[model samples]
Structure formats: structure tokens, C-alpha cells
Target: MNAPTHSHPRVLVTWESKHGSTAEISYAIAGVLREHGVRVTLSRADEADIDDADDGFVIGSAVYAGHWMKHAKHFVQEYSKKLLAKPVWLFSSGPVGNPPKPDEPAVDVAEMIECTAAVEHHIFGGNLTPSR
Candidate 1:
């Protein structure tokens, strides 16, 4: 018998954050992968000119007033072709500060996830207050 596994080569955790929290989240995730002896690369979404990384973590922090920071959205849109050809995951940081009102629209991260063929997707609660 053989252990089931993926063919992914490396893991990349890329994020675009405001007030630094999302970066911290990605860093923590990267740290865990490193501890497991997995090769990992991390960069700001704005700097991720990645065609593909055997496996990828496409993290994006939510910007309520608008949406994901432009750079993060661009990273995905710009690399949609490459991402769809490989495994990718997206994450966001937000829901802080002014809580989204009942009328506030819900952010839909699914469309992007499906387009990327990402093995999985996740959303972690983040500080919404600007004071931090």
C-alpha cells in the first residue's frame, strides 16, 4: 500500500494585508509548513509574480469598503490561467472595525476559488478596528 499524496512541489502563502494582520496569518501558516519540512515561499500578493508553485496559497485580506485589496485581486486575475492549471487556495483578513451592517453585502470568495482549482479555501476572522 502507498500513502495517498499530492504531486505538489512547493507551497506558497501569498497575502495582501492592511495593518499587518494578514501577513502575520500567512507567516504563521508558512511557519507550520516549514516545521513539517515542506518547502514554502511567502510574499505579498502584490509581489507574487508566480506563474505557479507546485502548490499555492493565495491569501487575500478583505477590504470591506471595496473588496480584496486591488493588488491581491490583481494577482489572481493576472495569473488566472496559471492558477487554474495548478492548485491554489485563497484566504482573507477582515470583518474588523465597523462591523458590516445587515445591509452590507456579503463578500463572495467562491468564484475565485473555483477558477483556481484550489484544493481548499479558508477565511479567518481578523481585527476590524483600525486602531491596531
Candidate 2:
């Protein structure tokens, strides 16, 4: 049989943000993926639809007290079996300061990777405003 044909890879970019910083990062990622011709579905983790038709996933969350937001954690736990069958990437956004304090990864990152079999994880500097 001829090799199966497929459309552009579809990626799900989902995030949980309490102050909107993490969500912005997710949007940027989705934009970059789109620029590269990948089809992206951007949504909040709690509201994201886990579709098997997606070829990969990029999940992110705001880190609070060294842990990922609950909605993000629940999303990964809820769809981990499906995630493991595809390419998965994880990100945590939190560390606000001139030098970006906390200089360490989120506490639950290891567990999340284990659950999702994610290929990579990234930690991005966060944005915090006094008014927030």
C-alpha cells in the first residue's frame, strides 16, 4: 500500500494562566508553529478538547508555590494515555524579577513529564505587575 497521506500536522497548544502571562506564551508558541505551517488549536487547559487527530501537544501552566496550576495538572492526568502516544512538550512560566528568582524548575514538572512522556520541558521567565 502507498504510504498514508496526511494534512499539515495539527498541534494543540493549551495553557493555564492565573495572571495571563502563561497564556501569552502559549499564544506565541502557537503563532510560531502556525508560521511554520503547522495547524494549531490554542485553548485553556481546562477548556481544551483532547482530540486524537492532533499530532502533537504543547501544554503550559503558571507555576505557583513551585507547582503547576491545578487545571493544567488535571488536564495532563486526564489525557496522559493519549499524550503518550504522540509528541508532547511542556512548559512552566513563573519567575518574576530583575534576575528572575526561583532559578529552579517547577516542583511537579518531573511528575508531569512522567505522566505524559513528554519529549521536552521549558521554563520561561514570567511577567508580574504591581497592580496584579
Candidate 3:
């Protein structure tokens, strides 16, 4: 179970979904942030308007080949300055399975970059199911 979210202003959640599971998680995250009084918006990583959104960000992507989707990576680069200056939370949706893996670990995409937002990154179990 996930813990409660931190409240903030102008929270933006950007996601990349090949089959929409990543999107679902991103929306849930935005919902929780809104519940906590954060003004949030969920959009495709490529579609986010990063202009003066200097408050906060909640960026996420679906992992593919041990990496974040290309669009999400680009989004981070595009908003690198604003992100670093603001509070940010990064997450990924991947490594779907039932547990018991000694070698495999979760990967957080935003952590790989030089984030501008004093960001905390997390990765959640993601679905490979086509129907999800």
C-alpha cells in the first residue's frame, strides 16, 4: 500500500503509456495529490505545459528495456530547469510480477537525470497485460 501524499501547488503528472496501465497509475497519483489540496493535472509527458509550473511535478513513465519511455525522458529534459527548482516526485510503472526476485529491482526514471526539483522517485509494479 502507498502512503499518503504531500500537499503542494501546481502539481503536474506526466506519463507515457503503451497500453494505458502507466496512465492509470499516474491519474491515481494526481487524484491523491488533488485530495491533499494540490492543484494537479495529468497529461502525456509530451503534452505538458511546463511554463512557470515552478511549484511541483509528479512525473512518471512506463519502463521499457530497463528504461523510461522516450517521451518521458524528453519531457524531463525539456523542463529540466523548472523541475530542478521546484519540488518533484518521480515514479515508474513496470516490473510486473508477484514477488520473489533476488536480482531484479525497481527503477525510477527521474532519478537517472539531474533533476531540478529536489525530487523523490518511486517505481511501482506495472502491468504487461494488453487489456489493462
Candidate 4:
């Protein structure tokens, strides 16, 4: 549904990035949403100020050892109430190199999905160094 010009629907894009890649992805998502005329706000998960006024949310995190970063987990826990009441989407970035199909949600985000009743959960392939 589209909102009137006076009140454009706002979507918050927040994420916990370990090496800036996740942040870049978050920004790209925000840009696309903006191009579609949706008001978007990009913020770090730990620094995000999620509120009831937000129409939707796109939360992301960098997965480490099959788990989302700590700040991302805390962010979800801290704002579970507000997030659950609105349209929310969850995403995680990990599993470098050739992307493999994951049968299930990441360890940390699984609980968040249940808690927020998220509309969808997406897992993105991450960038890793050769040494890593």
C-alpha cells in the first residue's frame, strides 16, 4: 500500500557489519527503496533508533561461525516489541566463496524470526579473504 505524499512510508535499514561489506549491502538496499519512493533510513544496528513510527524494517547482520554478530542479536532483543508490531524482514550475510544453499535460518536469526514473526528471511553470501 502506498501512503499519501504528506506521509511517505518509512523503512529502516539497520545492520551490524564486521568489515563494512554488510554496511555496503544495507546502503544498497536503502538506495533501492529510496529509488522506489520509499523513505529509508540507514543505521548501524547498535546505533539504530527504531520506533513505532517506522512503517517497516530491514535488519541485517554479518554471520560469524554460523551466528549473527552480537550487536545485531542485541538490537533485535532490545526492539523486539516494536519490530514485531510492524512489517519486518530479516537477513544475514556469511558463507563466503561459492554460495551454498542453506536448508535453514542462521542460528542467531532463527529466534529473532520467531519473535518478530518476520515476513521473510534471506541469507546472503559474504565476501571473505583468501586467508580467512
Candidate 5:
């Protein structure tokens, strides 16, 4: 008997951005995944389709006042059962300034990880523009 061979892994990269910075990061991450031959679907957390047949997930959100945007949080909460079956990675974009103010993970990250059974979490620097 022959073993099964899988096609390129499909990954969903979703995010919620208050001022667009986090969305940009999500796009960049998807681009890299595609470059490595992964099938990537990039969508906003609110608009993303959780039912897609993805092998893994990369979820991100912009942190404001130490909390993730509601849509991202809701996404995790709403689809946690599905998410728990696969590998999930979480990211937060916030803490601006030289050396990054606060220099800590988003306040809700721990809970999000627990809910999704995420394998890892990353914190990225955010860009703050006064105009937005």
C-alpha cells in the first residue's frame, strides 16, 4: 500500500486592524507563506470564512488599550471549536515608540491562546499616525 501525499498546506491569515497597520502585517505574512509554496487566504477577521478547508490559521489584531479588536476576539470565540482542531498562531500589533512602549503582549492574548489552543503567539510593533 502507498502512503497518502498531501497537497500544499492551506493557511488562513486573518486580522482586524483599527488603523490598517495590522492588516498590512497580515498581508505581508501571507505573501511570505505563498512564496514558500503554501496556499494562503488572507482576509479581515470580520470577513474571513472560517469554514474554508485550511490546514492552519494565523490570526492577528491591532491592540488598543491593551485589548484586541472586537471582531478578532469574536472570531476566535465563535470558531474556537474548529480552531482547536488545527494549528493556530496568534499575533498582536501595538505598543509603539522606540523600544516599543509597554513592551508586553496584548492583555487578552493569554485567553485567546487558551481558547484556540494556539501553538504560538507573536507581538509586533505598531505604527501610530496622528491623522488616523
Candidate 6:
């Protein structure tokens, strides 16, 4: 892990996960960012404090019916201005099966990305546990 070049490089990692899968992704992301010497705060979308983080953001959510969770969407709406002024990255966790179908389209965060002018976006495979 490389030490962050910037002083106090804080990153806020927020997400919305109905089944804990997306939260796992958020934690993993936070861990990686911390390993790189970034100060990280991991929280649910509704719980994150926009003012608490000034450097960057990594926001993610689980996709359902081809859309992001409502709380995640609301978080972006509420913090759009602040997010736009900083470096932001977006991620989506879906495509549950081991071998994702080729026809599965990527999670759509284009509107949010446009609003924040996000530096990057990623879509990751998710895990689904069937209820017994």
C-alpha cells in the first residue's frame, strides 16, 4: 500500500445494501482506501455526513429492478452540490449469479455521475443468499 501523498486525504464510503452484500463492498473499498493511507469513514447513505468529508467520496448501492436504492438516490440528490465540488467515485453491486449473464447491463448511475462529474464508476458482482 502506498502512502497517500496528500495530507489528511479523507474518503467517505457510503452505500445502501438491503442484504448486506453492498455493505461488504463498501467496507472493502474503505479498507483499500485506508491501506493507501486515506482516512476513511464508512456509513450507510442516510447516515453519512457530507460536511465531515472534504476530500473525496466513494458511494455505492445495490441495484434492484435495474435501479439504485431509494436512500442512495436521495443521498446523491441531497449532496449533489457538495459532491460536485470534490472527487467522487460511484459503484454498484449486482449481477448476483457466479457467471453473470452477458445481457446484464451495467448499473446505471449516469445522471448522478453527470451531476457530480465523478472521476470513475464501477459495477461489481454481488452475492445472494436464498432464504431457506
RMSD of each: 4.8, 1.6, 7.2, 3.4, 2.1, 4.8
Model 2: CA > 4 A from native: 1-4
Ranking by lDDT: 2, 5, 4, 6, 3, 1
lDDT of 2 by residue, 8-66 (tens): 99999999999999989999999999999999999999999788789999999999889
Best by TM-score: 2
Model 5 C-alpha lDDT versus the unseen true structure: 0.91
Tens digit per residue, CA lDDT, model 6, 1-132: 996465769888999999999999999899888898999988899887786445989999888777889888889888889998999998888867758542454455877787678898888877888871
Per-residue C-alpha lDDT of model 4 across residues 5-122, encoded as one tens digit per residue: 5457899999999888788889989999999899998899989998666899999998878888998889888888888889999888875645454444577777989777899988
Better model by lDDT: candidate 1 vs candidate 3:
3
Candidate 3: where are CA atoms >4 Å away?
Answer: 1-8, 98-113, 130-132
lDDT of 6 at 76: 88
Q: 23-54, model 3: which lDDT tens digit per residue?
A: 99988888887888878777898887785743
| Clashes (N, CA, C under 3 Å) per candidate | 4, 0, 4, 0, 0, 0
Candidate 6 off by > 4 Å: 1-6, 101-108
List ranges where model 5 is wrong by over 4 Å: 1-6
Candidate 1 contains a number of clashing pairs equal to: 4
- Pairs that collide, model 3: 83-116, 83-117, 84-116, 84-117
- How does candidate 6 score on lDDT? 0.83
Question: Over the stretch 26-75, how does candidate 5's per-residue lDDT look in tens digits?
Answer: 99999999999999988899998875578999999999889999999999
lDDT of 6 at 56: 89
Candidate 1 stretches greater than 4 Å from native: 1-8, 51-53, 97-108
lDDT of 1 by residue, 72-100 (tens): 77777787887877667677666554452
Choose 5 or 6, whichever is better by lDDT: 5
